[model samples]
Target: MDPTAVGRSGAVILRPMRVDDVAEAERLSALAFAVLEGNSDLTRPPERAAAWQVRTAHLVSRDGAGCWVADADGTMVGFATSLRREGLWILATYAVHPSWQARGIGRALLDAAAHHGRGALRRMVGATTDPKALRRYRSAGLDLHPTMVLEGTVGATAMELPLHVRDGRPSDHEWMDSLDRGLRGAGRGEDHTLLSALHPLRVIDRPHRRGYAYLAPDSTVELLAASDRRTATDLLTDALSGAVGADVRQAHVTAANQWAIDVGMAAGLSLRAQGYLCLAGMKPPSPYLHHRALL
Candidate 1:
């Protein structure tokens, strides 16, 4: 077999990512993002590494074929992990070492990972502000909707949540999965276990009303899915009950989720355009907020 069956020189290769690659992939991913979002340099908290490893491991376990890694010698320099569910294909994570950017490695990994979505009718990914990544998604045939973020101190005013919304329990998993199917064209399934563990899930379930939101301790909406725009707004509003006067943030807002933007701004939070929500064969799901890695 040819050594460079994947690309470049024999020293560099693109191949199926192994489960063991998750550790290296997580490190490289963090370093790359730090560089991308640099205020001047890069740093890591050290303790947060294990959490990402668990998340990355789940992706590999569920869809190994949808994950790929770029290896130069024995080191993992780039990787992409994706998953296909109920006719929807989601790009979970895509990153390349900052030094390897613009070298065609990202394009290769994207093409490889996207193959897993071949028969899926819809595709989605939360993209960053990086120009090259945006171009790659555009070239792949996804329509781009600029992403917005609503962030600031939650005025004491916005913390009021309606009566129907309540703390989600373990029993709510099935219902949340149902909402996932209705809104995003798929069910999160086991992914829910991971998400709920990371951020406690908040829910609203009633006749004619059903929705879910994962709220971090800091009050950011990690993810939200709902039956209607109003339900979606309520769930988001509820996420901020404990964030009053603190510097809070809600991210991953797209034009598809204007209700969130409206509710957020009405609470005195500022809105700004950041990355994008790229889609193919679908429109942005309304009253929905997305998790960067999971969505």
Candidate 2:
């Protein structure tokens, strides 16, 4: 399928994203999110712009076939990246230049991503705090549900677990995939593989049960997937303990998953903000904690 099949409309063009578009995509993403914050209670860190750029580049490098860009004449106006793994397709990051909003560029870019993954996409998911953005996603066929962001300083804690913690290895992909599927109802093999290589994954090895959490280099708890609340708490406790030297540690939890939220609060984290997890074609699983952008 030619992602660029939808050609120029007046001066706008919808096309597949390229490796070179990452820098501009990062700029537009930062600008778009900053503007979005102005319309909602959401807050973004000053360093997120650079962080988003790096994440965007990684997503493009990992799944370029699922990324698309809307170009106005020759300048990029908008972009969207979707990560397809098994039955899931996540709209990982999406943004349009503030100057170019309301002109259908965003819609086109979104459509291109959906089209590119139509054959394999069983469910689609995304997150946003802005009502206008919610409307756009709803209009595109997703159902919105409440989610929250929890953040606070990470400190040493004395929570002991029955299982031992160890760094994840490539051989553990099968266990990771099985655990993720059991918890989230979908497998994120590709995402887990990429993240494991890019960041450190702290794993709990028990006799029959296993769990894992991704501790980013910056000490943020990027994601945690476990079979039960106790295992989840143990993983999070380990993550927060390791994050003792970092300025901040954060996690995005589904509102329905009060256990996970309580775990964060018990670990000395506070409610930072709230948002919605919009899903299309499936119900979201509970007890899941991941970055909002990756929802």
Candidate 3:
């Protein structure tokens, strides 16, 4: 159990998803994402409530998704979702009922999830156009990596953590909300452009497809050649040799990923210079890569 998750009045409860909690989760997301503190563009369509429903359905499905709800005085006020991929666990979505914003509910929920996810040295990400979310993440010991927007090409900072899969799934949902939060919060992506980019690739041949199973349009190619500049250049040259007319002109690679960076350079993929942040409980075995190879 999460010790930090006491209610505002010191009686709040942190618990797993319940049969009847779906509606409340939707309601909280509507209130929170709709009138988010800083981002106003999200209020323009479908109502935040409608968007919440769609996101909730994605998070609770049996495809390695996890969720948690917070109740204050028996009222559902906040919810969080975590999505799992091969070696990565990302916080996909989270919404706090408007009535319960500044309280410790969010932190408590995060703590509980993190506690449960012990020994994984997790890399979690969060996105928020809302100033409040940015503040909350910072307060909760998350540092800013790179601030990116998914506009013409997918551009965003990548974070990493080493996690051991249990029963072929990640241990928790605490980090799941970050990816969706970043995308929706960034809000620069359009369905048409994404579909157009992803439509032509019938076969995506890339090495590392872990952590990014949710990529929709383009296939992210992940393989490390060598740490040296020459190796980086050669690896990319080889990868793109077979990529003629495969429907991708752009890609993302973690700055720390030496081979991918070399590939990006040789292929004319300009690094949209931004503040990229990195965290590790211990040194990584090799340079970790975060690529925007797919949606």
Candidate 4:
């Protein structure tokens, strides 16, 4: 589809994200958050910028059709990226340059995502700490769920179960997809592929059930999917132990999942920050850890 005007005036246009827009999107993302947090940095640090680029590239490459950018006149002012997995639609990232705030750009981009995700029993999810953004999400019909960011040094905890942990392989795609579908209520095939390629995908196999986690480059656990509290805690402990040398490890824990929070605390992780998971449509009843931007 061609880039089309989404604003009331013809000056503002909305279009699919291209490879060239990655850097600006990253900068805008950082700037938007900095402004919301009352920080001085206009752009994120080098490591954060690089990580954001990687995530943006992953989303754009896998689901570019649902990614939209807002341009005011000839300048890019905002963008929104969404990914579809099974019946779930995730608003991976949405940002508007601080200078362009208060305009209808954000709403326009959100409307574009809503339009693209029309069919199916899709549940849309996103995370944000910004009150204005949360208000916008609510205006767009999403209900908010509280969440917390947990971070700390990895503890010396060990699991004595008869489970085996191994690096995920290409041949394990079907098994991983099925496990994800059963736990998350959606099959994130492309997301798993992209994340597995960029990060260390660890699979935990047990007699009763299986679990998985993605170890991000920053030594944080991106996603931890498991059937029950025991499996989830085991996977989390494994991920945390892998970050032994790192100063700290982080994970996004949902307030609804008290067991996960307890596990994180038991593993020596402390509360770092808090946010909300804005969701629309049917909610999934599973224990899973996710990145704030991509949840």
lDDT of all predictions: 0.84, 0.71, 0.43, 0.72
The candidate with the higher TM-score, 2 or 4, is: 4
Task: Give the local distance difference test score of model 4.
Answer: 0.72
Model 2 scores worst on lDDT over the 10 consecutive residues at 39-48
Ranking of all predicted structures according to lDDT, beginning with the best and ending with the worst:
1, 4, 2, 3
Task: List TM-scores for all candidates, in order.
Answer: 0.93, 0.85, 0.49, 0.88
The sequence of per-residue lDDT tens digits that candidate 3 reaches over residues 1-295 is 4334442436667776553566667656655766764455434345434544544554455322256777777887776666443333445566777667787778766555444334444445546555566666667566555532111222222212113211112221222223223322211123213222332211112233212222223333332213233433433343344443444443334434555555544444445543233222322213233322111
Root-mean-square deviation of each candidate, in angstroms? 2.4, 3.5, 11.3, 2.7
lDDT of 2 by residue, 1-295 (tens): 4556665556888777887888788777767887877745233464665666666777788778779888877898888898776666778888888788887777677777776557553555556676666777888788887776667665456444335778888777788788766655467766666577557888887876577888866555687777777777777767666666455656467766677676667656777657777777666665567655555
Off by over 4 Å in 1: 1-10
Off by over 4 Å in 2: 1-6, 38-55, 119-121, 155-163, 245-247, 292-294
lDDT by residue (tens digit), candidate 4, 1-295: 2225454434678888987889888888888888888888777879779877987888788788778888877678889988777677778888888877777778888877666566646555656677778878889788877777777665666423325767778777777678777755577776666677667887777778777788876556787777677777777666666665455656566665676677667667788557776777655345778655555
Predict model 2's lDDT versus the native.
0.71
Measured by C-alpha RMSD in angstroms, how accurate is candidate 3?
Answer: 11.3
Q: Considering every candidate listed, which one attains the maximal TM-score?
A: 1
| Candidates 1 and 4 compared by lDDT, better number | 1
